[model samples]
Target chain A: MDNIVTHAPDFFSNSQAEATKAIARSLWNRVLTSVCVALSLLTLVPLVSIIYLVLKNGLPLLSWSVFTQLPPAAGMVGGGFGNAVIGTIVMVGIGLLMSGPLGILSAIYINEYAPASRLAQAVRIVAKLLTGIPSIICGVFAFAIVVSTTGRFSAFAGGVALAVLMLPTILLTSEQALMGVQSAFREASYGLGATKFQTIVRIVLPDALPAIMTGIMLAVARAAGETAPLIFTALFSQFWAKSLSEPTASLSVLIYNFSTVPFPHQIQMAWTASLVLVAFVTLANITAQLVFSKKH
Target chain B: MTEDAARSSATQTPGRPDFLTVRNFDFFYGKKQALFDINMDIPEKRVTAFIGPSGCGKSTLLRNFNRMNELIEGVHYSGDIKLLGQSIYNKEVEVIALRRSIGMVFQKSNPFPKSIYENIVYGLRISGEKKKSVLDEAVERSLRGAALWDEVKDRLHESALGLSGGQMQRLCIARAIANRPKVLLMDEPCSALDPIATVKVEELIHELKQEFTIVIVTHNMQQATRCSDKTAFFYLGKLIEYAETQKIFSNPGQKQTEDYITGRFG
Candidate 1:
């Protein structure tokens, strides 16, 4: 013990140098931390400012009449894009109906049935490429296919446009969700003598359902907010759509039309429509989060 | 009654009949060979244990019994594995039907995210048995067969995931046996369990051998001694020795088997 005490003084003498090194490291850590915090706050600026601006300008025009009444003539007052809101909902619903089952079933075939096949690999590459295509091209494609054949713009054409855009999102996300299901579950099912179809339907799909729902909800939000595709397909209708085959008004198209017109009341209505669209997207996102959290 | 009499009289010992016979079996995963030429006759109504180090091909052989390895992209085998007198790899043999008659339990406990009752009756449901009374009876019987009915009876309607790890493993056993398969393949069933749970599973294995032909792959040498009637020791994808469990542990024929059991080296 006495021999150890003689060496302890040397250990204490180097403590000052160790303290200096620690201070230098901590200063660098603090500087990096501040820079990250500053950058992250900067990213939030656009989102927060948009929300603040929309609420400030849009709140005064938001009323029951805005939801109930139809759009008035140019330079007139006291009207709402009620038909446009309904048209958006109907068109997105139609797109979901068209694409939801197709995407999910194809994903199941790709992930569970033919995961390693060359054809499945090719399909996956094409689906990824489709996601990066410009939205306006989808509008043009639908115009060529649906509008030219039907002889007029219609909600059905708008739905086709939206479905094309939503397909890649749903397919890729569902594929990822299916892949994320642990292989242990499938192995256990197969061990118990389940057929491949039975194992996929009973064990794999139910396990991946929540994640698939989240993907669908995200696609729904994106489809609802799209503007360019609706313009070339659905076009704009001053009156409510009488049928799916007729021209339809949508909130995105209304905002596009009304925001640029030389009238004060129409401009205010556009801001109110923007707020409603944002709310719809927010609600869909919240639903997705809720569904995902319930699984845990 | 006459068939039963003839079958009983054919074998002098209770567990002497060859239930599963493997001859010159070689297994490969893609280009990599996982098991060398192997031969063994696993007896009916007896527990056979495979003991080896990691990557020694014990688990691979166990999976081949039910053809579970076919789930991989590129796995192939040579020679043949026969259940009863029929080759399981025959062209006409449906792989699904072959698997139905031979059940399996994995090393890690994996109960589906479902009610305990549904988990146990999963096999029956897939086989098209939907009568409520029959399903309820099977659930009770299988859980009792696994010695887990008493602890989980009241919670049969609850999610199987809520159970402890040991309970979940026992649940898996119940599910495997729900179809009343002729053979049960267990791959290191108690490796993830504690000592107490291991003892429970080992005891269950002892009781299970009276009805099902069991083939187990385990790294625990003591477990083989405790629960198995026959033991096969392997090293480097080759079967080093096969004998009665008593003889293998007390008087191993090969130097490698002795070195492995005595902790000289794996």
Candidate 2:
């Protein structure tokens, strides 16, 4: 009773009442933060495991020759990913070329110029719907329109399919980036006697640059690893690419083809190719983050 | 100056036959009325400030000067706003061209993420100035007019985003004046700034009125007192008081105006 009385008197003390409340509030916040932190970290374990395994499988087959050689054969010894690397680069570049400007212009219209008109609303709805369309569905649509029309698989058709797949994401992200810019900036430009187009071109675009770049990079990475669209477009090429207008090979398709083959060498090559594609994607992600964030 | 050009501001002002006149103005954002039955005159080559509490239509009135409110979705208005005697809202008028003749500055210092020189010349280039020497001269003149020349002349090529908050505000002012617009509108141009920066901006405002008809919307009563030649106090989209600066400060005619100035209520 004596101990309780001493402690109880302090608890009831006027000077400490506010302090007790503050400490309890902080404790509640800390507990809530810990639960959220733990839940997110737990979800990341499997992702880390997959990357680690891919890296482990890839390290042995990767070499200067792996970069330079063609696929060895069904049962043969040595082949490299040079052709696949070039094909991926060219295809992605072409896809970006086709989609980037349209996406940016469309985003500008939606975010800046649109006045809630029926046409504007319809365009937005269509873009939203397009974003949800499956990559396989895009592939099938391209195969029907392109493969049957051209009567052959070609990199041009693959590029077109990839462009279609990439456009919606680019449009959505670009719109978000444009919208993310504070209206104050636009108003500031207008205040400075700039035309609306000038304000968008000069002030708004530059401010939203880092975010827009991030979106473009996301599109690029997604395009780089896409296989379904490529299968309908890019055929199995063992030889070097003569032109982008014709047939070619890519990492995703090569990996898919080799991974299903009966030979150990081809299987190893598939792992190597997958590793390379994963690395390219990782490098793109890291580059975007590092260049944008000054914290690190 | 020609004798004809040296006559009344009405005859002399480029493109403006007289003052800024808002006649029978009504504003709607689709169906909701934001401004109604507004009538006022902003004199040429003078400073007129719009003062009101939040949501009292101060900023909306400022934007009406340049038709910026048109950028918003569902905003509709019926008014005749004549800038220098030119009917600004005429269907035949090009909004982009009209905006070029009237400059604007915001509460937040919004410098482009570009070089100081580029920020200044953005408007000129947009209006189609391609000569390098001319652009350079205009950049210097604008910076000088904005009271920023001495500070930025050595670093015109440097990114404007690197400047201090006050410097960025001045850079925006420089950009606005580079095109030599006949009128300038400021929307609480220094609310985000420190006291020192606010004073600098106020001084700039005083200097700017000599060449441009300046209209500002300010939350700070002191800013209106220090820099304005004429004060227009707005309440619920109505012009409650419009008079000489000194008179409005010393003897306001309305109870609401007095309360706002004295901080009795926002």
Candidate 3:
């Protein structure tokens, strides 16, 4: 007891020093937190500025004619990119039609049927590598396969390019979505005497449908904004495409073609076209988020 | 009832025939043996409970009855599991047909993310039953059999996920019996339920044995004694004891069985 009484003042003195250390530690914590907040806000600056600039420059020229009339010739005014909008939609639709089933089926095969096989592993690695390939290379590959064979730069060829680009995204996301379904669901279906195919189609596929739709929407958004592939394959027609075999005026190609011209009217149209493209992509992404959120 | 009368009642009848017979069963998962040479006879229309510690091959044996473990990669078993004297592993016996006649309920309640009506009819639907009247009748009968009809009868079209945990488990039980399989395999079906839900499921099990042979794998000793007619105690992937549930709980033949039941050690 006498020894403890003697050490009491020393313990109080040590605690005072420890309190100072704690204050320093808390000060460091607050500083680090502020730094993280500032860095995250900095990361958002480009996205915000891009939207702001597009709205500032494009909203003035945005009118009903933008979706109703064709684009004017260089140095001319009074027309809009109505054909380009349709072409974009048609080509993206074609891309989705080609990629959607193929991607989803392959994903199902990989995840549900042959998950541990060497072939599945190889396919997975190939899909991952495909995602990293430049979008321009996909354009070149499509040009070789479809453009050379068809002997023309056509909407079909552009669709082929976008399909190649969208395939990896759709495939990987669909696989992830299928994987997200609990194994318990499959076990229950199997336990109830459902065959492999029945279990997948009836139970697993239904559960994964929302996520697969989300992936498709995201792929659609990406395919819409892609400029390089459309440039090489579609090759920018001024008039509306007569058929899928003919060259088409997509929104991305129109913006690229018009932005380089010295004409002020076409430049303003480019800004408006940029706004339309941004809006389309944003709508697609928002729809994807909504679909995914609703599922959870 | 007195202990003697209860024991006599729980004991198998003299002429009762075996529904499932396991002969020299050995199981492996990628070079690691999960079960050694095992032998057992499960009688028809009786509830047999498999009690064991974790990883003691109780669940594995339960799953093998329906070939559920075959879904996993690198699982193989040597041993003839005979269902009514027909080898389940025979080349002529289709696994799908085998599974259809052997229904299983899992430890967790896994109701399909669908309507209660659809969930009960899933098995029949996959088997190509399309008549609406027949499906509706099956839904009612199975639900009543599982003791869930009164609670969910009015909301047959509602999603099964909206039900409480106990209700969902009963719904699963309802779903399992919808096919009217010869044998029902339960892998800790009541482990996820509360005390009230456990009692309800236990009572349901007692009622179900009148029509189906039930093989339940459980960790709870009291549940084994309360619900099962015959009990098989397992330890370290071996069958330590097999006898009437009353005899096993009251006077175990093996020290290991007594140790496990009395909570001395797993």
Candidate 4:
């Protein structure tokens, strides 16, 4: 009671009250700051350990042959995984070709053309649901559609599966990026006598390009590492991919398959393949930030 | 500019031919009506200011001239708004061509996040003006028209986002006038500007009136008096009184108009 009475007038002035408040704020800040820092450090542990293991196990196996030859037979160790690298690129390229335009256009329609309509709302909800569905389910879907019809596993089927997995991510992220564009810009464009199509094509899309590219890169990176979809759709091949109609090799599926084999050489190659997959994903993200951000 | 002289002059001015006319206009957003039974005539090559408190439908009436309010979904209107004696709402009149003749500036400074030069020529480019020399000349002319050329001429290619708030607003004005529209609608163009910037914009408005018909919506009573030739006071989405700028400020005929201008109540 005495302390409260002593500080009453100073409280109105806020000088005396502010000093105590500052001290308490500093204490709370220190505690919360340490807690957040500790949580961040904890989050880094899994990522650091994964990198350490990949580097430790895969560095000795790295060679020029890794990019130039086919994988060796079960117990032998002289060849490399040029086939898987090319197959991964081809599948991912096809996935991008199929999903990129479709996803971006759908996002544009949802955001710009019919944002508040029931159809757009339905598309948005389904896109969200698609993202949450398991990757294996996407593989099963592609298998049911393409593999069952063709009676064989092919890179085309794998690409379709991967594209299905990428579609929801690209759609969601592109919608968010396009929506981030200020309504003022749209109004300005409209005020200047530009048609809706002209405004979207010339102003809205260009402004959202950097963010849209980031979304595409992230989607592609996720598609590149997908293992379940490719296993069901592409199956596996030891030879270089000759056509989109044939079974194709991929880094993720190869790692999953070879890591389980009893042979020592195949297991070592699995680690190398995992390292390469990680490198590809990292390079994709880096290039996206570097290249697209420059335009902004 | 005296009170009695201004009243007679405004009363006689109503006989002049109107450039834009709104007749028994009613506007709605979905089921809720926002404007009710508004009728007014804006003269050519003159600054007609709409002064009212917030949500009084001043901006709504301005937007009708260019059909900008149609951009919002579920907004419908019942009225005939004629631009140069032709009904703008007619199905025969294309919205793009209508907008090309009537440019607008928003209350907020919304310069595109592009370069200064690109911002000015955006309208022209969309209309298929591709000659570099033509675009370059338009850039200088529009910037000069908006009184922004001197400050921005050195960095025409720099991002407009790098400009100051006042500069950005001026850039928007430059962009709007680049199309050389017959009528210009400014929705509180100086509301977001500082006093100095506000004065500069008012000066620009005075000069622009010689070339284009201007309808301004403003909350600032002094701005309406300073910049507008004819002043219309709106209250509760109704036009209470409109007269010469001098008469509206000095001696309003309606109690509501007098109360609003004197700050007794909004």
Which residue ranges in model 3 land beyond 4 Å of their true spot? A1-14, A288-296, B1-15
- Which candidate, 2 or 4, has the higher DockQ? 4
lDDT of 4 at B241: 89
If scored against the real structure, what TM-score would every candidate get?
Answer: 0.94, 0.85, 0.93, 0.93
- Winner by DockQ between candidate 3 and candidate 2: 3
Give the higher-TM-score candidate: 1 or 2: 1
Best by DockQ: 1
- Cα error, residue A70 of model 1, in Å, equals 1.1
lDDT of 4 by residue, A148-237 (tens): 999999999999999999999999999999999999999999999999999999889988988999999989999999999999999999
Residues A176-228, model 3: lDDT tens digits? 99999999999999988888899999988889988898888888988998989
Model 2 spans with C-alpha error above 4 angstroms: A1-44, A243-247, A286-296, B1-18, B91-93, B255-265
The candidate, 2 or 3, that scores higher on TM-score is: 3
Q: Scoring each candidate complex against the real one, what DockQ results?
A: 0.69, 0.45, 0.62, 0.65
Query: Where does model 1 sit among the CAPRI classes?
Result: medium
Compared with the true structure, what per-residue lDDT tens digits does model 2 show for residues B1-266?
75335434543544342478999998988898888888887887788988888988889888888888977778988878897677998887777777777888877887767789888998888778999999999999999999999998899998888899999999888888887777898988899899998899899998887677899999888889999988988888787888998888899999988888889898
State the TM-score, rounded to 2 decimals, of chain A in model 1: 0.93
Clashes within 3 Å, all models in order: 0, 4, 0, 0
Judge the docking of candidate 2 as incorrect, acceptable, medium or high.
acceptable
Q: Which of the two candidates, 3 or 4, achieves a greater TM-score against the reference?
A: 4
